[model samples]
Target: MHTEIQSMHLRASQKQLTLHTGVYYTGMDDEAHTFCTVSDSLQHSPSAIWAYLTPVLDRIKAEVSDVDTINFYSDGPATQYRQKGNFYLFNKEMADRNMKQATWNFHETSHGIGVPDGVGGSLKRTENMSVLHGKDITTATDFVKTVKTPDSKIRIFQVTEEDVKSKIIEKLKLQPIPGTMKIHQILSVKRGELWYRDLSYNSMEVHEHQGQHLKFFSFWKVIMLYSICSLH
Candidate 1:
């Protein structure tokens, strides 16, 4: 959903607040999890994304202990989810969390509609209704408390200013990956390693690169060769 701002009422002055939503499916049951991460920070950068996702992943892991691999599906937006920084985090965070393997699949605009959109719309309406009913929600914290109900399916997590500051975004040492825009799929089977392709196909040829070390992945691979880069 669009970034939810404070003072949602039209007449009230608004401050930009972000609400990042993810719909998780485990396939073990019919239940669906809707995770909403609210943050006061206006940043939509990779570090901000991590600040939002870390808590959601923690909750997911606590409930789904047996799962190893994760597959992410989203519309590619360079600054938010499709940049080199995100790729670095994808590999590093998965390894840090002890996940076996993972894949991030990007869908074009027309094909990107999914459950997460519905979750966002529903919550937006909920927030609007709360405001209409004279409920005060002037901050991300207020928004979280307002929407949280005992029987509600939506799980809420808050990302504080401290969380953003502690991310050390400036020191991430991220370097842009080539053809990042054309890449629709990124796969990681091991720590500090990733395989990316413009299209997702099982029979497609892949390449590897040599020489050089990286912080999270020892090497990065594409359809042709694996290249090495370093990050800390």
Candidate 2:
């Protein structure tokens, strides 16, 4: 999911809200589900991303109880999903949620256009049509209430600023993992392990790493290492 600024032409307020849209694809069911989280908070930090994603993940698990693995495809923005903070969350949260394994695959820069973008565009167009029909979507809450109906195709949820703040508090202490920018796939198969490589198919790089490298470092441990690296 990516953050998009969706402007609403309300008769009074006319504010812009952040729309985090994601399209979920299930191969077993052969169906796609589109979900969005509307928030007034413009920050696209790791906390905010997780805040937007939590409800969607919960819904997925609720609907598909047999799902043990998840695969995510998104653009690689360091400030968002491509950095160390997110990796920590990805490793910790999957285990917390009883998920067996997960993989995050990042599209190369400037080539991320796909179904998620279409979902966002479709939402913008829907909101635009609503505005044309004399509906006012002045705030993020209003956007969610106005857009999501019983028969709506896209399930919309609201993420308050407090939710993001709480997530920030929950994942407060984090250490930046080295070589995050060069990584394209992060795969977590065990509780405290994350396997990553520059390209998903680059088995040679994985082989050079001496097989199954990149063990998960706890926050305090990584912080100590970070301090050591800073001194040198």
Candidate 3:
């Protein structure tokens, strides 16, 4: 499983607007199906991306019931899935679905390439051709209506501000894992425990859930102190 977040500018009534897109692809069984959503906002923050992603994942899960382990490949962008908050959400999803293990692999910066790029490019080119042919794609609804293909697996959604905001995961109280900023390859958190490897480390550190929970309490105390100071 791989996903990519992309943004495009759409023209409507001579006004320019932003549309955020999430593309998902699974290259199994020699057949690739693409799932996507388009939102009229540039705020493709972690929450927004999660909102668009969860449903697509659920659909995939239903279809591929025999698969026990799932691997996600994505580009490392801090504001998006390559962060702690998204990791928590991913863990919760795995637990809820009863998956054995989930691994997320981040492609090295500037070296990320694959099905996502092709999907995004194909959609954009199709939309651009419609525009060149005098098709009016001014609204999210308009874009969806105009960009349909007979054999396309793409499912486009028109998202709203409230829809995106509702998807924000509750902030975890855990402290940042040491050396996360230097992480370049893989981050795997299974069943509430965390394991990570950075470019400088030869081996991954496995942090137990109990120890991490203790650190969470300590981290919460500091946050409470800061909140109290701001209240003064």
Candidate 4:
């Protein structure tokens, strides 16, 4: 079906003769849009889960800032949990090891519950504004209507990695892939729909570290940055 839609009203500055187009899609993007087959950007995160959620820890530090002991794999209480001061960070790296599609996957600190038993929920919407890739958000917005997939009921993009990869390259105007990954925070969760697979991103950041220790440090870096940005 083809039809000519009415032109959108635009806002512009009159500093010069040429008028500026309104800032393209914003309100629509604030709504949830799927990025096809979702994947954790930190699939290869260091074996240490605490190391991964360091960003959220950093974010919540100001509000819950009273901790002398930060340990991964809690002792006496929980074994599969890690802590930064009093806050905790879950470990879900290997469980979802296809981070190539991830640009940001750091939104789990505030999103997680107490543990294996306490892992009641994972927020899929709390995002960091500064570090996120506006491109990813724009891509999501620009194609929200087109993101429908064969199975759109669950709200998936149906767009494959190849589809996004091409757009990314074109949109970013890159000469090469640069072979790097960015971090993001997750906001919502589907609860009980396969743990690791249920995780998503909220914010984003880029990394250029060696893979061996990348996940470990990246995990913490976001936690730290999370604290800084949350305050702003």
* Tens-digit per-residue lDDT, 48-160, candidate 1: 88888989888878888877988888899988888887888888889888887788888875885678788788888998898777786768988888888998899989999
Going through the candidates in the order shown, the clash numbers are: 8, 0, 0, 28
What is candidate 2's lDDT per residue for 1-232, written digit by digit as tens? 0122343323455457899998897647768888888899987888888889999998988888788888888999888899987887787788888877788888888994787788889888888888777777768977887778888899898989998987773424565666778787888766656777666542323444432344343455665666687789
Question: Which clashing pairs does model 3 show?
Answer: none
lDDT of 3 by residue, 1-232 (tens): 0122233333243433344444544535666666666666556676777666766777777777666666776778887767766666666666677777666666677885676777777778888888777776766667778766566777665666677788675553544556555554343335565455543222344444332211211233545766677789
RMSD of 1: 7.0
Best by TM-score: 2
In terms of lDDT, which candidate is stronger, 1 or 4? 1
Query: How many residue pairs of model 2 clash at the backbone?
Result: 0
Clashes of 1: 8
User: lDDT for each of the candidates?
Assistant: 0.75, 0.77, 0.60, 0.25
> Which ranges of candidate 2 are over 4 A from the true structure?
1-14, 169-173, 201-220, 223-232
Off by over 4 Å in 1: 1-13, 201-232
Please give the distance, in angstroms, between residue 230's alpha carbon in candidate 3 and its true position after superposition.
14
Name the better of 1 and 4 by TM-score: 1
